[model samples]
Target: MSARVTLYSRPGCHLCDEARAVIERVCTEVGTTYDEIDIDRDPELTERFGEEIPVTFVDGRQHDYWRVDEIRLRAALGG
Candidate 1:
């Protein structure tokens, strides 16, 4: 199966932005598809991940929260 990645973020969040950029660059290099989710737009997601805006998931599993670790991400994606 193809790898799936998702980023949970909100506007004006510096860490979120950084996480997105990291995901974009790594996903591009690793040939993976990713989607960004704005937690503010969803009540359940907002409640579950409000404090940790920039949470990331790979294949529907929580990969990281608050920050992006490139090495962990690469390993998760089998890079």
Candidate 2:
């Protein structure tokens, strides 16, 4: 399957940094990969998630924003 996780973020976002750490750890433990999209690079994404960076999508659906919950992420990924 393609990567089931997607993180929408921009550079220098502290929450995005934190989310990345959590996603990396959880995805690694679950043997799954993820995609990271820089919202700043896309006008649509920037408009959609400008105020809510660090957004996460699991299985093509919105999962979380601003912060990442490790347990919830693990559960979502069926880790």
Candidate 3:
């Protein structure tokens, strides 16, 4: 089964940028497909994850926040 990862982020968020970079690298290494969501574009997402702009989801479940835990993410992807 393929893994689907999603990154929730917003503009001007350094942590979010860092997390996205990490996710991009990991996705490339693991050959997984990922998408990034700008929470600011959606009111519900903004409200749900405003304080935590860099939330990550793996296979539709909340995975991490603030930063991308590479070890944990690798495990999640079965890498």
Off by over 4 Å in 1: 1-3
Shift of residue 77 alpha carbon in model 1, Å? 0.4
Pick the TM-score winner: 2
lDDT on C-alpha atoms for all candidate structures: 0.91, 0.96, 0.90
Looking at model 1, residue 71 earns an lDDT score of 85
- Where is model 2 more than 4 Å wrong at Cα? none
Q: Candidate 2 or 3, higher TM-score? A: 2
Residue 51 in model 1: lDDT = 86
Rank order by lDDT, top first? 2, 1, 3
- The residue-by-residue lDDT of candidate 2 on 6-66, one tens digit each, is 9999999999999999999999999999999999999999999888989999999999999
Which portions of model 3 show Cα errors greater than 4 Å? 1-3
- Residues 1-79, candidate 3, lDDT per residue (tens digit)? 6549999999999999899888888899999889888998999999999797699999999999998999899899888
41 in model 1: Cα distance from truth in Å? 0.6
TM-score for candidate 2, residues paired by index: 0.97
Per-residue alpha-carbon lDDT of candidate 1 for residues 1-79, written as tens digits (9 for 90 to 100): 5449999999999999999989998999899889998899999998999788799999999999999999899889988
| Cα-lDDT of candidate 2 | 0.96
Show the colliding residue pairs in model 2.
Answer: none
Indicate the residue-level lDDT of 61 in model 3. Answer: 98
Worst 10 residues of 2 by lDDT: 45-54
